[model samples]
Target: MTKQINLPFDDSGCGWYAALAPRPDVKRLQGRQQADYAVIGAGFAGLAAARRLAERLPEARILLVDAQRAGFGASGRNSGFVIDLPHKFALEHPDPAHKQRLLRLNRAAIGQLQGLVEKHRIDCQWSHAGKYQGAVGPRGQAYLDHFERLLGELGEPFRRAGREELKAVLGTGHYSDAIFTPGCYLMQPAALVTGLARSLPPNVELLEESPIRRLERDGQGGWILHGDEGSIATPTLLLGTSIFTQEFGYLRNRLLPVMTFASWTRPLTDAELARYGGQLDWGLTPADHAGTTVRMTRDRRLIIRNTYKHVPRYGRSTSDAMREQVRARHRGAFLARFPQLADVPFSHTWGGVYAISRNFTNFFGELDQGVYATACDNGVGAAWGTISGTLLADRAIGAGSEQLRDIEAVTGMPSRNPPEPFLGIGVRSRIQLAAWSSRSEL
Candidate 1:
């Protein structure tokens, strides 16, 4: 059996969270309560699930619970790219149909999020800036060529650019070539999530800092969730807790928790901006999977994300030593790309968790009686989480739709991982090997 989850909260500040203005305080779950439906984990997916449920069943008493404040976990800590393209490795799947399904789902997710942002008038610095898949060297360039080929097969539009074009757009000569895909949006993740949580329908109750300790089926055909301060009983439950779902022993070894680190520099001064001339705000993903991800924010801050580790447990925080090591790596990557900004230092450094599967798939559906789940984002959390949550809610309510079918067909449950100790060892070894191989790109 999987061990119980002790939800981890990162004390190190997230630049995105710090950038946002203070939000009004939210209430925490106290004492026992009963609801018609309970949605665990108030990240992107849980928020979407609870909102959809509220819209579909206006009278239903829906409870949305989170271990920490809304947007304070992986949802707020991400690099804030709502991508509409398949992951670089996703194209490697032999089935072209699978790739197409992925593209459709990703686009659908982007559409859903766009609608919410517009309807609610979210002020999260949302922008349709698209993104660049940049290549650092020959190997990275080859990866870009493969991506372009895949894009062509999918009939997607992209602009191929060489060193000069990339330099003009990114203000750096680090990348040799790149493909610009115009379907991604950049935003302030923390603000977006918190806004979404606040905007949830009146039928839903938002409860933060309520970590579920255990969940079990009640004898009366309902579910009981035990948390630190209180418990909740509901006839139906939807879980969007990502890797923390292991507490239910649902996917167990199949879902792996990989932690990635990111850091953000303070806004550049006018002179610094002039020295680093380029488009004011842009985002770039690396052609190499293990390479660094860079984003120039609308507020003139530069963010860098790279490095990965396997961490199954939640409460254990990233050590100061590891933070320093990753910080050094980020510094090196930033200087390599923008030598002129070598003196600028990062204002904040933080880590986020991603639930990955060996087959690069997701787990969505009813895992048990009256218990539904949508998780395992495979490193693309923002979009995947949104769509999965919406679809899962539809499934729970017995509402059939083409999108749900597509998601089910494309993203079956992840394959089971190897047993315990060996599984951890293998995952760590793979991460180390990949990091070592991508040293130059870093």
Candidate 2:
């Protein structure tokens, strides 16, 4: 018997969602609907695909569906970094030309999002303040050195900062050294996704609270999507559901749903800010891949993300024991870095699912006749998903570009995963070992 997959969005208690303004009401799919093209998921990829489809086929009906409101899923739950460089620990492309091409694709994604945000005047607190990669000790410094060398080889500009300089910027002396890269943009993730959903072309219809229970090919040469309240029949379909695609038997063992936790503290008062004493806003990723990710938001709240678990069920509701465990980890990381803010308490904690593949590539291409997919974010969902969505849209419409070619060269279906019982055992053990190894950084 096949194991049933649980929905990741069922109970993601994201602090980013609560921090944003109240979302306007959106209509859910209630009855039978037909469209020329339908995009499922409504995340970074789905939203981008729907908007691009609308632009490409003005007369064609486009439908965008999601299980919950826009930005309520992983898209909104991210740490808000629109990274333009390769992820800190991702495998580097062996060929210099291939690496340059990949960087161009990342920049294109950032450029596309920047254009959209500016054109729509979205009030998502979009900031050009680049990010810092901070190292905690000898191990972290070694990782930073490797990262710096890769950046130099890629011809990317980055500056190294000493301990004092990092303390001034990060307000924490825990990091021994740092590298600042100016290509990243930060924003309130929930706000940006919500705004993007709202600004989608008028021709694209967004239906929320419409969880797709099943999808099948219709006998009449189209696709039938069964939702909680309705069904949709469309000629063309795009799956941007990320790891949830496993529920449909799409990526099966080829993708793993990794749950990562993040917590946000209550906004600090003026006196508390003075006591903390650092730049009011900044984001820093750990030099070590498993180390904690910290951010000081524009609203004076501190955010910390750490810990990873391989959860096959994709259930978003974490147990109280697990929550407390993660909170303890978060508190330890926070206090170790900023003892001055020991009194501050985290207002919320949540887990989000990210799909990882063994080879660190994406599942991007046509899966079947009239069916397409762009999943497996490889831990850089914001920028990568956006670009993949745009390129997938272009591919569906028979339009080609240099960007599409570059993406095609690097992306494909993931390698198969180990079978169940052992897969779980191995993944869990690996996560535990990694966490243990990076305990000091966390």
Candidate 3:
């Protein structure tokens, strides 16, 4: 049996989900349930996968299960940018052709998500206002220059903004330089995921607050997923559980669970909003990977996200004390950027988990007979994860396309990581070095 040691639970300090209305009672799995296909985890990937599978196999009974309510985990805790270009921190490839393929895939995801939001009339405050990649010091500027070169090579249009222009647009002089790329979208991530779950096809049954505790093979060619109150049997299993996939006895030592924290301030008063002379809503990504990400919500709240920790213990390591320390860092970063709103208090703070691979490749294929998975999306889970999950459904049914081949060619396989203590030491040290190098940007 594959035993799960950790699970995705609600982080009460998540402002994204807290800002929304309460959900109705969850339908947890009970007794013996059967599904033709089971898609685990209700985040971006699982939702897309289940939706796609349901679309193709209209007669199939598909189960989409999650440990907590939809959008209460990493999916909702993100900085909420649906980026359309290759991420700066993703594995670097010198081939422009490879980069172009990635760009196309990400854009395709954006288009797919846009269609659903419009069709369902999801009220997620969706925006196509673009995003700003900013630099605070010389090191960050150098990274931004590299990013600009990559953008140019990909034939993507971008506008450069210096200090004064950035200040005028963002209402802060903290950023020395920035590039505005007009293809990205912004929205409340939690709302998007929850809406997607609610709007799934009639054939898919979504079970929330049902944590799969263990997995064991059935006597036949199927598998049995054991939960606290019930079990599920399915001939086909697809896991989109992010880092938690390791607990199911696959992809061991091939993925890293990185913890990142964010803090959101209370809604700005009319006077405070006037004092902050920037656009009403805007998102800024740091040129340095370790720097801070800042955003102004449509509802007039400011969000500050930064800091990384390699927590092998997963959620067990994110204690209240640790969250408090991270929140303090966020407060410092927020004050540095918006000192005019010195009295603006943070209303929520939380830490989230996302998986990355040593070689920057996600697992997106069959793990064993009758089993498949799509995990480790690096940091671009919003777009890449969505597209990958959609394609994974197609691949599971023996379907093929040029897009599938392109993604497979570029994302070969996740490289194996070192064992235990060594791996922890290396990752933690690297994180510290990166943070130090990007200190000014933070």
Q: Which stretches of candidate 2 lie over 4 Å from their true place?
A: 1-5, 10-12, 89-91
Off by over 4 Å in 1: 1-3, 315-317
lDDT of candidates 1 onward, in order: 0.87, 0.87, 0.90
| Positional deviation of residue 404's Cα in model 3 after best superposition, in angstroms | 1.7
Pairs that collide in candidate 2 are none
Per-residue CA lDDT of model 2 for 1-442, tens digit only, reads 1232466554556888887777778789989999999998899999999999999889989999998899989888889999988775453778777677678888998999999999999888788899999889998999899998899888899999999998888888888998999999999888999999999998999999888888877887788888878989998999888998877667778998888989989999998899888886799999889999999999998999999978776754457688789989889888998899988889999888889988777899997778889999988899998999988999998999989999998787799998989998999999999999987777
Ten consecutive residues with minimal summed lDDT in candidate 3?
88-97
RMSD from true fold, candidate 3? 1.1
Per TM-score, the best of the predicted structures is: 3
Question: What are the per-residue Cα lDDT tens digits for candidate 3 across 183-251?
Answer: 999999999999999999999999998999999999899999999999999999999888989989999
Model 3 ranges off by over 4 Å = none
